[model samples]
Target chain A: MQKTLKSLSNKDPQNIILIGNPNTGKTTLFNSLTGLNQKVGNFPGVTVDKKTGNFNYKETKINVVDLPGTYSLSPNSEDERIAKSYLEETNQNDIIVVVADATNLKRNLLLFTQIVDLGKQVILVLNMMDLLQKNTQEIDFKKLSKKLNCPIIPINARLDKGVEKLKEAVFSYQQKENIFLDSDSSSSSIDETMKRVGKINTIVDDCLTKDGEDKSYLFTKKIDNIVTHKIYGYLIFLGILFFIFQAIFSWASYPMDLIDSGFGFLCDFVSNILPKGILNDLIVNGILAGLGGIVIFVPQIAILFAFITILEDTGYMSRVSFLMDRILRQFGLNGKSIIPIISSTACAIPAIMGARTISNYKERLITIMVAPLISCSARIPVYTILIALIVSEEETYGIFNLQGLLVMGLYLLGFVAAILSAWVMKLIIKSKQKSTFTLEMPIYRTPRWKNVGFEILSKVKIFLFDAGKIIIAISIVLWVLSSYAPGNKFEDISKKYTSETSQQQYSEQEISTLIASERLEHSYAGIIGKIIEPTIKPLGFDWKIGISLVTSFAAREVFVGTMATLYSVGDADNTMSIREKMMAAKNHETGEKLYTTATTLSLLIFYVFAMQCMATLAVVYRETNSIKWPIIQVVYMGALAYFSSLLVYSIFS
Target chain B: MGKSLNMTLDRLKENESGIIKQINDEDLAIQLLSMGFVIGEKIKVERIAPLKDPILITSGSSYISIRNADAKNIEIIV
Candidate 1:
């Protein structure tokens, strides 16, 4: 950490702090200023994202730290608290660039004036100047600059207009002593804030002139009338959700397939080029396989985040919160929790991170805890292979495809489980913070595609690097466990398979597969599976299923791959071959056919409820800043999965 | 009779407009004041949610959503 600070200071980049109210395009301005040269880090002791970047002007590089958007220095949430503390700790030389919405100058200046009273070097950049002009409202920024004793630059951040001038202003910033309110004027903070607003209102009225009436938000209000309508509002939200789901599952699969094959080719190339040995096996099967699993989810995550960003950028997200607040509050979730819950269907890593919008600590915690309960895209493969064991793909009941209906039923079960769990958590968790749904409803506008692109890039980067590290580490460990045997057991199996009688009885490919399966049965993971068989037998899962469950902790979808390995199925993708093998198998004691309806349905229920994804748990730990929450999540969800599967097995049998 | 005369923002019907009187809750008042909800400002209830708890209100060019629990804290003049 000290080394990083030294490297950062070595550049001698002048500090330019960016602060603003929400929906003021402060982040858009930061992106324009820094371009692609930015890094997201955590604040000193808090989990709120600290976005820092640098831009070069002429010969000097200027460092910019984009603080979280806040209404005033008096914070309402952890995010705002970080912004306030960071501002209070700023060096005298650092220039505070307050980005204000040009259309709503009165509220925006509340923050600007607060910073000005702090007596720091400050620059006020009026963003959304185009909207101001379109509304026929004029801000005499030149006069306002003199009146407020700060540099005022009008720039449209979306269009990147006058940004250079804003930079030039920052480059030559001069500190001034301007206080919006006297220190001892009011007894309470509310009175002080009101006094400040009164002062700002007078200053704003003197420097602003309007022609006719402000109509910029009139169009938005009209759209809101329909979008927020009692019946039409819900229908529209559902329609959009349907479209997004289709794009994630259907459209994202094309790119996902390309990535899958690309990784497969890479693995093949590496394995072929390197000589066969333990090192080669570790590289090909351990590291590369783990990496391949992670990269495959990128397309789906990117698609989900892109749609979420667009929805948020166009200001539809706040309206969604307004519509969902009352209903979700009963579950101890805020309306902002809806985005994270919906995003959970694609992947919970991004969804857990998306819960940052919920300011209330309890609500955000519950949202994160229950998000993984929703069926994600990763569960699809497991559900498909398992469901196919009982019902064929073409089988249907009446008009609906039976297999498809089961998949839908599993998804609905997951949703119900998530909501119910959240309700339970709401009752148990204690919090003193007052829950409030005070959110700004920004006017609807075209999404800034550039910002959306940047958002996807950053979210994917966090998933790939932050969560990716843990996933890869866990994958290598699982590989070692399943690849190596306790002692000479692996050697003994290979030698037996190479004997003349065995070679004659089986073809070369069949012999190798038999050796592989036998070796796996004696391997550490397989032994662990055996040890847990008694515990899981009531749920209708045998030792082989136990092995898959052990491996599935790396990721739920690994159940399919592990099943193929244990069954000696050469092609893991050949679900038919594996299903046939599983169908023909028998219980060693009872001599009854395995893969019965009871076992299959029980396994399906298990996969739906298990907290088996390490990547998601790692993210939950980071987001909650506690190992305790993720531990509680695993314990509760595991118990739920166990009992639910047990109940299903009894009913089916 | 006196209780009926003391109007709160939450009691205002959809499309009804009210002038800011005082916010009983100190924290909510500070938050509202920063969001341009001054004591003398005119706030209009643009829409009430279908569930009728959180309502959308616009004061000047600033629009926001607040729950009825919070709206009950703000005294207003119809």
Candidate 2:
């Protein structure tokens, strides 16, 4: 015994670990106990982070490690490996928190008994107690504690109930006499164990009483009857998706306009107060305009996430997964792939990170590669502006606005492209393991508002922080590039314009327009745009459009701001909207219409598939732990975009 | 005739339960058990949700949900 113990100790350090099944509110409990005093670190050699939070119990500083949630410690997947190895290697865990769904106690206790055999301290937290009332089930806590030979605490984690009792119980925990395996008894064989288990069942039956039939299963069944109905399930799913898109487009309009107008008002106010200088121009035009371009889409992003969060929280997402399994399998994806695919609509970075949850490497890689093909919110502002410019708002099919339908079609095109790409990738990458899809359909519950709100706020904040920084920096650089030059052209225009009228005669718009055009024509950016003009000419884009495309590569929405700045610089009248100005643009040499249907379609196809954002690439690099993948991703996506646009242009022209 | 294994619903019907003889795939089985399908536990199939996917089972002092695909993998005693 001493030698065995020594060998185990030599293998790994002893530590206390928290273990639980997924969706058991384990993370919630961990958060409550640890609060914000937690740090995340990777395990010695693994990419998976080891989260440790300090908790004090009876003046003893306990290092609480929140292990990844797994169904069993049987290490089938990487997540399970970390959890199982940590428990097996660590002998010093003072206590183990076996969080179980209270509504599903029988399934939860399997792990409970396994932990008991480990001969360590154990506490069972029966989470989601509030769910029991709806199911009309009651638990005999004392009886459960006696049967398991551990303290049983009932908890409603979302509401913070039973947390104090849980903490107090942990502090006061005293190890009871250990249940030892009978040595020298060959009765520990599988057959003998089964007989022993039968005896334990008798013990359990005596200790616990249940009230009412299990309604959770019944409720889920009733809902699934319609939702999973052969034809109806598919239709309802489509209907739900349609409603979500409608809500995103319609509901977010008011808040988006408010934010847009608010920023415009602020810019005007700042211009009125500050003396005219480069600093003022930088703040009002460069910083404020660029930030406003990105910020206005927050409402649309928030609404999209809210619907998704509610669906996921209510456990309907799993059902959707189940429905899509057979279809997704054909594309070399499983039901789990639906999550990343759905999340990609918000931003490809988090969607790529979400692929981490997919247990299969091949599937995960495929998902990461193709996720960006889904049109994200970053693409929305660009698409919105372009659609408004190209597609008239006349009624189509009698009831549908042609513009709305065209926007919906663009979204559908991206979806189709993503599926087709995944299918092609599936044939390229080979896997031998028999892939299986297994998910626990959690009981449906009303989505907790706090959880939904927290999710939306965190996602929005991350988007604003990461994408906002890149946009601001790029905008300032672009401003400087388009503001100054090494030529008499800018100086000559300023001098001519200022001398042509008295200082009191010139309006702010007139003077600014003259300065803007003169500076832009001789600027470094303008020189580069002219150099790239030959390449973009085949696609029917002028030097100005080429400049906007180059900057928009940082983020798709930056295209609108780039165009706005470009047009604002050249337009002396300053009376028309950006859309009208774009419509009225003509080629300098031939006086031909620049934005013909052929060029518009070609540009639309280009934006549809291009790897446009550097931030997304950086995130992909970080998540995949290799620059190789992001580089490969950018090249493949760019080639696809170029060739696809070429094909579309040739056919149309 | 073999005696039935007294296990939770999640472990039943995929095959005959024989004292849960040995949970060969321990990690996967343990997860099923922790959801409340433990050894020496009595479970009954409550119902299955839409698409015949999520199976609802009753064990310990409560009800729980598990995917049907996962349920088929569980070896149980009848």
lDDT of each: 0.82, 0.71
Report the CAPRI category for model 1.
high
True contacts preserved, each candidate? 0.89, 0.31
Model 2 chain A: ten consecutive residues of lowest lDDT: A188-197
* Residue-level error in angstroms, candidate 2, position A354: 2.4
For all the predictions, what are the DockQ values? Answer: 0.86, 0.24
Best by DockQ: 1
TM-score of 1: 0.88
Tens-digit per-residue lDDT, A166-209, candidate 2 = 87877676755445233246653444334434544555557556
**lDDT by residue (tens digit), candidate 1, A502-610:** 9889998787766766676678877888899999999998887887798788777676555644553222222234456677766645879878999999999999999
Cα-based TM-score, every candidate = 0.88, 0.80
Once fitted onto the true fold, the runs of candidate 2 whose alpha carbons sit more than 4 angstroms away are A1-19, A27-68, A82-96, A112-122, A133-136, A146-149, A170-206, A392-402, A487-489, A492-515, A564-596, A622-627, A651-653, B1-78
